[model samples]
Target chain A: MIMEKLKLNIKIFFEGAYLSYVGLFRWLSPSTYLATLIFSPLTQMLFFVLIGTYAQGTDKAYFYVIGNALMNAAMSGIYGVTMSIGGDRWDGTLPYLFGAPANRMTVFLGRAFMHILNGMIGVLTGLLWGWLLFHIDYSAANPWALLLTILVTTFSTSGLGLLMGCIGLITRNVMFVNNTVYFVLLVFSGANLDLATLPSWMRIVSNYLPLTRGIASARLIIAGHSLTEVLPLLIEEFGIGLFFALLGYSLFRWFEITAKKRGTLEVF
Target chain B: MSAIEVINLQREFQTTIGVFNRKKKIVPAVKGISFEIAGGELFGLLGPNGAGKTTSVKMLTTLLIPTGGTAKILGLDIVNDAEAVRPRIGFIFGGERGLYWRLNATDNLRYFASLYYLDPAVSKKRIPYLLEMVGLTDRADEKVEGYSRGMRQRLHIARALLHDPEVLFLDEPTMGLDPVGARELRQTVRNLQDEKKTILLTTHYMFEADALCQRVAVINKGEIVAMDTPSKLKDSVNDLSVVEIEVFGIPPETVEKIKTLSMVENVSVEDRDQLQLLLVHTSKGAEAIPLLISELNGLKLGKVTTREPTLEDAYVRLVGGE
Candidate 1:
């Protein structure tokens, strides 16, 4: 019986994840997906890399490349996952979702599952863009370690996305909130700037955020550092991601109860 | 056991009144209304636009929590045991909004079926059967965005029945459909009733309630004014006559003046294209017609006829033509 239940849950998780992702993007033409998942991020990366190389010289291009490459995870995690969750309300599926007998945790967490994978792809695309454009050296990097760092980073970023998605339930201006958070992470997650150059307060804020340690750890691993050398940062990055995901889940549950109590489940 | 039960259920919303000096006001949407449905009965809730019909349905479906009182679905408390109640009940709030328009009908059903925790084996069989039941089998693979209003509404019915829920809540299922579409949907609803699925339907069409429901509750201002079978509710207006005055551009004050006559029980206006049909319900049959015409002396009157009262007359009288 227990095995059956677990199997059912696992099925629900993957099916839900796939369906939601497909539901969200199926309307877009292939070119729109290319623009959103590929070209847009590419241009943003190029803009920052050009600026960074201009300021610190072309030799430090690798630093900016790795930093901006990981930002793709944030893009997918924050924007893509958020849209998947918020789309329920905008598309008028919230009531049906709330009315369903599905486990809330399974459904809610499944929302980020596809985006996590997408985020990993986005990060890889960004790294590939860097390799093709700037000749960044991946010869010394451990391929496994780099993959693990990308997974953790994307997971952490998606955790934050889940939280923002819950906030989308009550507020009308969710896009505004999403844009503000994305730009804030760009500045604070050490994605485009050196952590040492940032002020004491900024460094402290970065320490608590999701992508900060992930970005730092990615830089170390790409520079040929062993897993043990960057293990502490990876652990902290994973912890931060887990923390945000749980916080988001708690908020998601709270929002559900509160919306039901306040009769605002479909208010917006 | 009753398939659905309610006791003094209520819901209130808080709205801010002013911009700078915002004062909060508690507005009651459902004022402790109560009713019940038998296991296999088709029940209708008839009301005006803001008559708390949707709010009441929302609460019973576990989409919204009630501020007071209690409800049960098949003996499960709607509040305390919502999760247990959810799988047993399915609801379709009418219109094009509830569906995932980008996905094909089959995908939409599959997704919602998973949400209801139906085994893959069951949904695979159930999805196609439901599509056929709603007459959408041929177009099951088409994106819902391309579907007509009737088709979307039918798909909604299919989605709701994916789990074979024992009870269904349909809020204005045919709100904006053409006559033929409405008839087909109503037929589908009747078929569901024949299968012993208890249904709670809320609609503005009196004829629909008369045609489909075994019982209906006329609700107004968040309260049920009357609850009985269609014929019984119609019987309440049996003595009254409905004087429908077709007039061109009748002034609003004239309608109010007609209401002042002691014989007029209630008055409501219906727009029939360019002409307005003023419906006056009164116990004084033909004798009250001249008095009603006198109030509209200057207006261009088309046709004034008196007919026996219908379930709509009872509704207009019960809701006081709000």
Candidate 2:
């Protein structure tokens, strides 16, 4: 019986990923997909690279280009997870999901699977665009370390996304919160700037933000550092990610019960 | 054991009074109510909007926590044993909103099938069988966005049945369908009854309830005002007949004047284009028609007829003549 339940949970997890993929992109026409998934990220990367070139010459162009490219992944992770719940809520399916006999955590965490995968795709796409367009040097970078950085970064950002998604259960303006967090990651992730230049308090704040450690580690890997040198940052990033995932799971369960008590699951 | 046993179930909602100075007001949506349905019984909850019919269904289905009472579905406490109860029941709130518009009909069913933990081999056979039952076999591969309102409602039914649950709860299942669609859906419901599935249906349509339900509970203002088989409820008004006065451009004052008569039991209106059909229930049927006509004064009168009381008459009589 326990084995049967486990098998069911695994099936449900994949089913959730498929649903989120279809539901999240339902509004995207072919043209819209091109504009959103491809054209938009490329343009943003180019714009920031051009700005960096003008500000600090060709030498600094790689900094702004890589920074914005990594931010693309963060954006996808945050928005994708947020919309996983938000889409269900708007479609009037949240009540059905909540009322189903399935385990709530299993069902909800399943939704994160596709978004994290999509975040990985977004990161890789951005990186390729940088290498091709700006001609960034990849020969010196360790591919295995870079892969580890991407995985850790995706997990950490997705953790933050999961927590934000829980807040979506009670509030209608989830996009407002999602966009706020997205911008916070962009500004303080140490993606574009050297954290040493920031104020002491701001550096401390950046340490706790999603992608700070991972992005810093990514830069180290690209600068031809050894895996041992980057391992600590990647581990820290993974730990923070785990914390948010657990906290999000607990928050989700609490709000679900409160919604049952208040009869507010179908409100928004 | 009874399929459902509800005991003094109640629910209250808090609403803010003002935008600036928010003060919460606890308003009861479902007052303490109780009832029972035998296994495989086709039970109906009949009420107008805000009559607590849906609220009661929500609590019974474990979607909402009851504030004051308890309910058991298939011998499992809805609050304490919610997870156990969910697998045994299926529900559909009539509309197109609950479905994934981008997914095809088959995909939607398959998705929810997993949510209910149906075995893949079982769902593989069940999904197509349900689509055939709801008469959506031809359009099973089409995206839900392309389907009409009636088709979407049928798909909603198909989705609900993917797991083959023991008890089914349908809330206003035919609220916005055309006559043909509504009739077809009702036929499907009857088929489910033949399969001996315990069903709890809620609707505002009196004729629908009368035609389908074995027993119905009339709810108003969050309370059960009346409960019985349809025929028995209609028999309550056997001594009373309905006097329907057809008036052209009848003023509200005339309807009010007719209600003031001592013999008149109740008054309700139905619009027929330029004509207003006034159904007046009274102990004196034809005798009261003349008094009603005399009371209308200078209104343009159309054909006036008198008929035997129906379940609608009992409903209006019991619900204070909505």
Q: Which one wins on TM-score?
A: 2
Q: Candidate 1, A187: how far from true, in Å?
A: 2.1
The candidate that achieves the highest DockQ relative to the unseen native structure: 1
Clashing pairs in 1: none
The DockQ-derived docking category for candidate 2 is medium
Each candidate: chain B TM-score: 0.96, 0.98
lDDT string, candidate 2, A1-268, tens digits:
9999999999988987787668654434688656666678888788878877887898876677667777866776777777775677778887788879888888778777876777777778888888888888877788988887888888888888888888887788888988888878877897767788889988998988879888888777888998899899888999988888888889888988888998888886
Cα miss at B237, model 1 (Å)?
1.2
Report the lDDT of model 1 for residue A5. 76
In terms of lDDT, the best-performing candidate is 1
